[model samples]
Target: MRILYVTTSFPVYSETFLQREARALIKAGVEIEIISLHAGENSFEGYPVIRFNKGSLLKLLYLLPLAFFRRGGALSAIAREMNVRKPASFLNFAENLLGFGAAIVLEKRIRDYAPDIVHCVWASAPAAFGMMAEALTGVRFSTGAHAYDIFEHGGDWLLQEKLKRAALVHVSTDVAADRIRDLCDSGKVKRIRRGLNALPQAREPRETCPSLRIVCVARLVEKKGFPYQLEIYRRLKEAGIDFEAKIIGDGPMEEEIAAGIKGLGLDDRVALTGRLSEEEVLEELQWADLLFHTGVVAASGDRDGLPNVVPEAMASGAVVIGSPVSGVVEAVEDGVTGFVCAPWEPERWVERCVELQVDAELRRRLSKSAREWVEREFVADRNTGYLLECLEVVSG
Candidate 1:
């Protein structure tokens, strides 16, 4: 069956998990195509990755013809479904409009693809685009709901309508699934776990240390809670706990993190090693004793829906120190698999670090459990097979 992914962009260096899952689905005999609104690689894993020319509001011209001349008030009906509060959530509204305009620009290409499933990679504008495709081509549409899609301020503009309209709504976390259900009385929401491309063998002799070796893999964003991570490191240092940290990845907060490093007098102990490739990340994971994912709910209501690094870190045999947000808790059972603490509590985080440092037996047991957990619940082929089965049922 043909499955087309609708998204804002494709082949992003940071979004390797999406690429991994798409590759798995293709290997399992499902035909896949992608239409991205922004420019990126032309293809991924030998499948077409069509890019659309997303012009400015002037490009809203492409939509006017479709919305006004034809489609029988489809745009108006979609508009009517929206309940976005102006000024408060204008960004969400603007994003959905941009998604719809991009859809209009690529409507012909989407129709020619003739997909059985127009699967949106997000619940916001990408889903809006998929819904528009459904209105135009009569194809079944599905959406993915994550933290940002159904979080604070009541999610997207047309989230409820899309939730009801979609044949399926894939959510990576129980938190997201529960929120989606509350927003829309639709049975389409499905809790689907994200999986690794292939399980990374936990390196032997898990960690070699004189000092506590910690690594963090995340974009420098508000939701990532880097400030809290820095606070924990500071407290650990002050408490005479010898440790070193390398924060992998970079973003808008690069300068801010740099300043934090200096301001906290952690310049010697902490290093912000910009972005690293997937291979390099694994290398870091192998070198570290724990992967600290300090995530929180940001001001924009954005949070992580189980960052891929958590499972990757776990599968690599490094114990995870993830916040108790979204599905991080699902894979990371506190004290059993790894440790969980509130991002705001730097003292608790420092204590967990100390506990891991002192207890080698506990570390070994948790390492084994983390790897086992990934093997049992996060194998790409197995999870993607289930996804394929669900899609096949929908295709029928």
Candidate 2:
């Protein structure tokens, strides 16, 4: 089957799951083309990509008129859809207009290359574009609702519209699917977990240093709950716990996190290693005794849909400690594969971290179970095979 992937950005370091999914799909003998509204820093590698200019607002304005003329019918249909659901504020109006213009141009580009299915990576702008494309060309489209795409950007009317138009709606976890179902009042959604291509071999009982090495691999963002993790680390330090922490990944919150680090006097105990390549991450995970992945509902209502780092850390034989957010809950069974704690309770997090630090046997037991769980459920080929099954059924 042929699939057209519409996305906000291509080959993002933060969204490697997208690249993995594409690779898995291609390996399964399905034809795929990618179109990113905004280009990314990473190379597109093997896939054929159609990347658009998302640079200057002035340049985008200059192209809007041409886009309108090129696919006027599609733009009008999109405008009507937006008008019914979007707020009437100036910013919202302009944003909708710009989206419509882009969708118009995108629709023209897609018309001649009609594929069996249009799969939107996120249920945000790409899904909007896919909906417009479907309306214009009568082609089938579907979307995967991840975190902010479904919570922060989705609305009652907007989700209803997408649900009605889309062939299938995939969410990463059953908890996320349940939340969106509550909003859209639709039973058409499916749960499809993102999978990892290769997992680190589970560590056997081996002697290590006395100090526990903890690692957290996540973007420095609000939803990631970096500050809470920092607080947990601080409390652990104050309690004279023998541990060192490293936070991987980078984002807009770097400066803020740095300030927090300085203020808490955690410079000696914790380190932030900006963004690292996959190889570097795996190297860090290999030696780490524990992986702390804390997710929270940010002020914008954005949260994680099972942070990819959880399974990565689990497969690496690091005992996982996660927040009680919906997706985290699904991945971590308390005292089983991993431990779950409330984001607000630094004390609780500290206690759990301390337990993992002092008890080597407990850590090994959990690590073994975690790796087994990951191997059983998160193999990329099996998960993407299920995704392909969904696509084939939708295409038919």
Candidate 3:
């Protein structure tokens, strides 16, 4: 069966989990194609993409009335949902209208491809687009709701419509699924963990080094708690802990993070390796003794459902110290597999890192357990097999 995957971004440096799952589905005998609202820097090697150019707002305004006439019933349904269920603000209304126009464009693509199923990777604008496409074409659609898309609001009026109409909604964590159950039918929501591409193999012990090699792989965003992590590193250095810290990934907060590092006088010890290739990330992880990922709830209520880097870090046997904010806590296992601390507790975070740095035996024990746990639960072939089964069940 042919499955069309729709998302806001394609070939993103940070969202390789989507590609991994699509590739796994292909291996399971399902033909897959991607349609993205915007294209990114890296290109997927084999999979084909239908990229929608973000045309000017004037052009979009001109097309909005045409889209409304083409899918008037769909627009009316969204309006009813907004009035009765979740009242959308003016901003939400504008965004939804824009998404509707995009969906009309996608409908033409869907009609041409005539896929067996439509799957949206994000439940925000992309899901709204999918909802409109399904309405216009009578083709079944499902959505994979990630962190921000599920939690944050953007024309949330459309979400209930999508939920009621979608054949299935896949969430990466039970925490996310439970929250979604409040908005839609409980039976339709499924928990499907995003799986990793590789499992680490047995290797010789990492040789002892003079300084602790610590790394953090995350976009420099408010929720990532990069500033908090830097403060903890500063205190570690002030306490005379010998270590070198490297942060991977970049975002709008690069200047803020740089300023924070400078303010704390951590420039000598800490470095921001802005946006590296996947190969470069693996190379950095190879020598790193610890992966400190501190995630927090942003002021906007955006938080991680589960960062793919958490499992990848564990698989690499980099003793993880993650934040116990959301679904991240489920993966860390507190003291067993790795350490978990409150996002607000810098002293505690520093204390744990220092303990792990000094005690090689403890690090080795946790790393072994972490890798074993990830290997057992996070295999793409196994997880995507279940995903395909869900697709079949829902389609039936």
Best-fitting candidate, measured by TM-score? 1
Model 2 lDDT per residue over 315-354, tens place: 8888888888868877789999889888779889888877
Tens digit per residue, CA lDDT, model 3, 17-36: 88788778878889877777
Q: List per-candidate RMSD values in Å.
A: 2.1, 3.1, 2.7
- For model 1, residues 212-244, the per-residue Cα lDDT tens digits are 889999999888999898999999999999998
lDDT-best of 1 and 3 = 1
Off by over 4 Å in 3: 41-43, 56-74, 84-95, 153-157, 204-209
Please give the distance, in angstroms, between residue 334's alpha carbon in candidate 2 and its true position after superposition: 0.5
Alpha carbon lDDT of residue 157, candidate 2? 30
Better structure of 1 and 3 per TM-score: 1
- Per-model clash counts, in order, read 0, 0, 0
Clashing pairs in 2: none
Using all chains and alpha carbons, the TM-scores for the candidates as numbered come to: 0.94, 0.90, 0.91
